[model samples]
Target chain A: MTHPPLRSEAAELHLSHQPAPEDLERPGRRQLSPADAALMEQKVRKVEVAISLVLRVGVLVSVLVIAVGLGLMFAHHRAYLPLQGDFSYRQLTSGTTPFPHSMASLARALARGDGRGVVVLGVLVLILTPVLRVAVGVVSFLYEHDLPMALVTLYVLAVLVGSFLLAGV
Target chain B: MTPIDFVVSLALVSVAAGVLGSLVGLGGGVVIVPVLTLLYHVDIRLAIGASIVSVIATSSGAAAAYVRERMTNLRAGMFLEVATTTGAVSGAYLTTVLPTQALFVLFGVVLAYSSFATFRRRHTDQPLTVSNDRIANYFDLHGSYYDPAEKREISYKVVGTRPGLALMYVAGLVSALLGIGSGALKVPAMDSAMHLPMKVSSATSNFMIGVTAAASAGVYFIRGQIDPIIAAPVAAGVLLGATFGARILGRVASTTVRLVFVVVLVVISLEMLQKGIFP
Candidate 1:
């Protein structure tokens, strides 16, 4: 069955029509009005370039974040290795023994001097990542005139607030 | 086993569990609990605590990308969370008071049922539309996404809002009590009952599970169940696996993934039953 082309008359929307197979094989052939063809070509090129940039940036950022988080964790683990005592996993689970004087133990001991700050930092990081993600989504929605996404962002903000109050965070 | 040996062994098991769980989409708790109880002989309560923390780590890592993509229904997630949070707190309390063996048997049954549900074929021929719901209308709970396969925009509404939210409460409670990530229940409630598309339901479920885990994780931390050595490896492994899984989700074949998930759950359920009855 042949399907009709989708058209919206609610607004004068410019959409690029797909080239027929015959036209596609013949590289320079054009079957559209000059103005329409020019507009389509321009719009297509712009979107292609924009999408390429977005993908590149996204990959770069993801790699950088993963690398940094891994680096920090590894460095901390290495520093603690030397101080570790004859601590065995069995003793840890049994709960009758104290942890050996390892670097992790030292870090925990130091943190105990200022445990509140570490907890607060952990909570802040937890809260901020989601907020940043939602902010980016909201901006994208506003650009696209997508009210639903904006509303979702607002709802998330509300939830965060409610959770904070309820949990007394 | 000594404390050091226990921590090291638990870490190794957690890493294996995380890798397997990510592959199957059930999360690591299913694997962790059995490994701890049957292999390492850790108390069930302590196993539950460690599993919950790992759940939070996995969910948090996965949710970041979903939120960025605008696929996660943040409103739907939060609104449903009101019910889930309440359920989680209640469930945590109940876990402390209830009989442990009974809870384990009940959890195994739920896992078996969920595994079957996941294997069922999905119906995607239905058009997206809003059902009559005052709450949904008031909240403007409607969204559309571009379906690449259909090459069209599909709009959908939030239906059966109240029932779906109520179900999430139960899901949360069960998750806390059983130490299983509740995504299995949350995804179905949103997808089938609330009329959300499957992809959106999955992403939103991923986002919400972290919050539920965190509520209980805090309590576990206070109770000193979070041994740093055990928690560190579990958290790191789960975070890595979840992030990898989320990245591949859009490219994977849906049916194949679901089938794998079902098989894994069936195995886990049988293991749980065997341990409960024999041990």
Candidate 2:
């Protein structure tokens, strides 16, 4: 689109008197140049917001579940008796140590409303936070039509998810 | 002590660790691991399992602020994460094969480096001569963010893409093996080699550590290392503390945070070294 010469010249004059780079309070104002770059910036901003929300929610839910479990576990002397000798954390560090069998079993207990199950659910969610973050990244990059970056993030998500498969989960 | 009492004490300690870690920019793992292994007498694997969980918790909890600020470079973080996640998986497996003593020694060495770097800190790195690289271009691993401190937008291009990728692999390996956030190494790699500004490198490093720790966490989880009874309170405490720490960071003087870090890291580093040497 062609602008009138006088209007174009006025726009240039407006730009020339603009604030110095250091005086620009908003970082995006300087960098959000050209039409295409601005669009990319907006998309990336959305992705960041989405990622932050996912993480915050994941942490909040996990903390709540764990708090409930702690209240229950210590409400009486149930979990108190054996905790001394348990200080070495012997029971806490073995493979397939018979906590709730598997994630499915944990879910079942959660349905049953057991304290242990609630705690397990919290842990599971916390662990899955990064997986979810990467999943969002894949979608974010794909939305931007940046295949290399999308694939890059996809590879990371694959490794994270693949470990579960390798672990026989 | 009663289990409740023990758990309470552990949580209190973890809260302190989380505060100091976040304040010192080491995250919580570096502080918690030593406290757990040396003071609590928890097995390294068990302690590591909990530390890794706390790391994820803390990282995720802190993500929202950095992301919204746009200090974190999404494309750069994603590209580097490919290398980090793979390295982390490999390192996690190595933990099963390697002895605990070896981990202690490695942890001590890493802590020493972390301490030295913290003491002689450079919040903004000196720019590298080379300003661009092919892989960086391919992945679009460059970014610009508004720096409120400078009152301007800071734009930078990444360089030494291949070297940065390799260093990231090492960072991932260290993170998995030590159950650390690995920002200590990742920041340097990006700041020095990749030519990212200090803000972007550290912010981006923070993002990658979460994903990398998650990759190793799965293996730890399946192995029954993540005991909810122990992990739940510890993670909760760290998250609470980290959140609080971030809020107060700007008010606290940088010199003070650095002084605290120097003292903490020096003590932790020596303890880990002794444990490794004696064991």
Candidate 3:
């Protein structure tokens, strides 16, 4: 894709006379080589890709875990099967529905090979996905040498973790 | 109902909720809560718990592609998370200690207002050329995204930073207290207050809602509100539906999307007001 030399040269002359307004509007506007622009775009794109991958993987894993748990539950609990009118299902979702809520109880349920415990673990994974995204943002910002943003992201992470800890207790 | 019948029916309904929620950045709680409580006859607390977990699934699942395509202004989302996460944590705590009937009425009124505001400005696709907001500038909240529907790159500057952040705090609080993504509030804040393009606003809101929901998800879990039996199917269905919806977002017209969002807001507000007044 070669532009005619004379046309390109004339275009350059026109650009020299009237620079692109978008260039002037950019913060810290200055001359930047095409290579530099590409490099910066590449860097920004890398960060986007990384964040995207984290989210995709998190979702994939959580959904799979949940599906597996559902499978296990149906396999083990024949009484709660959909064949007949089962009060067990109703009781499990009712006002006094008894299930593990705390970590210690959850761990005990899991040790007993309870599928509900595995499903809860999957839910925990879903809840933490966005927290992990914040952690990634911290690293991405630090990599770009953006101290302010890194600190902002770190603060968000701290608040999320703190809320979890404070709530768990 | 049998266990299989229960799970399958709930999952099917949740898939519809997820599609709508993912498209509007609303996290489908608007649909999940009502369907589970009103239609399924589940307890309200259990319904809310399932809805909150579904919100996390919807946001993260939809946000994956939005981030990849640069529709999400990650910087803007992160910056606002500072305010939203704080608000959410407090809101989670307050849910146990405070009475919320009045708050529900107030939130409904606010949503009605936001719906009107969003409708009034539905046609402004052009981004602000100049923003004097020092905070937005300092944080580089400005960004550009490629719009496949328009087939062009759109660059935009952010304005009204202070007001946007304030609205987001309220959004977070509402979400935590009500088990919603609160995108009904967030899209308006970004569209009218911050003057971002509609698609960017929607995507960024979607990106932000997950963190906001995650902030309070642990609290709900500890309170025994998050029943794994109810939540597991909802989460899986929402994620699947959200993945499909995310593919359609970039191809849809922004104004059409905004209109759909405004409709959701109006309906939800009316429902909220009805519950507050009657209950």
Winner by lDDT between candidate 3 and candidate 2: 3
Model 3 per-residue lDDT tens digits across residues B1-279:
888888888898888888888888888788999888887788988998898888888899898888877898999999999989998988877787766777778778878877887887776567877666668877778899999999999998887677777777778877877666668778887887777899899888888888988888888888899888899889988998888778789999998898999999999999888878898
Write one digit per residue (lDDT tens) for candidate 2, span B133-154: 5566556566787765556676
CA shift at A15, candidate 2, in angstroms?
Answer: 37
Cα error, residue B151 of model 3, in Å, equals 1.1
TM-score of each: 0.64, 0.80, 0.91
Q: List the residue pairs that clash in candidate 2.
A: A27-B146, A95-B223
lDDT of 1 by residue, A1-169 (tens): 0011001110101111111232222234345599975875454344324432443343334334433433443454443333355533544455542322233443575465432223223323432343344445455545545466456655554544444445433
lDDT of 3 by residue, A68-164 (tens): 8888888888867755674546777897988889999889989998998889888888888999999999999899877888999999999999999
Candidate 3 wrong stretches, greater than 4 Å: A1-35, A83-88, B96-98
In candidate 2, stretches whose alpha carbon ends up further than 4 angstroms from where it belongs are: A1-33, A76-98, A104-112, B23-25, B95-130, B248-272
Which stretches of model 1 miss by more than 4 angstroms?
A1-87, A97-108, A111-169, B1-26, B39-43, B96-100, B123-127, B146-155, B268-279
Q: Second chain only: TM-score per model?
A: 0.81, 0.81, 0.97
Q: What is the Cα-based lDDT of residue B161 in candidate 3? A: 71
**Model 2 docking tier (incorrect/acceptable/medium/high):** incorrect
Ranking by TM-score: 3, 2, 1
TM-score of chain A of 2: 0.65
| Candidate ranking (DockQ, best to worst) | 3, 2, 1
Error of 1 at A94 (Å): 2.7
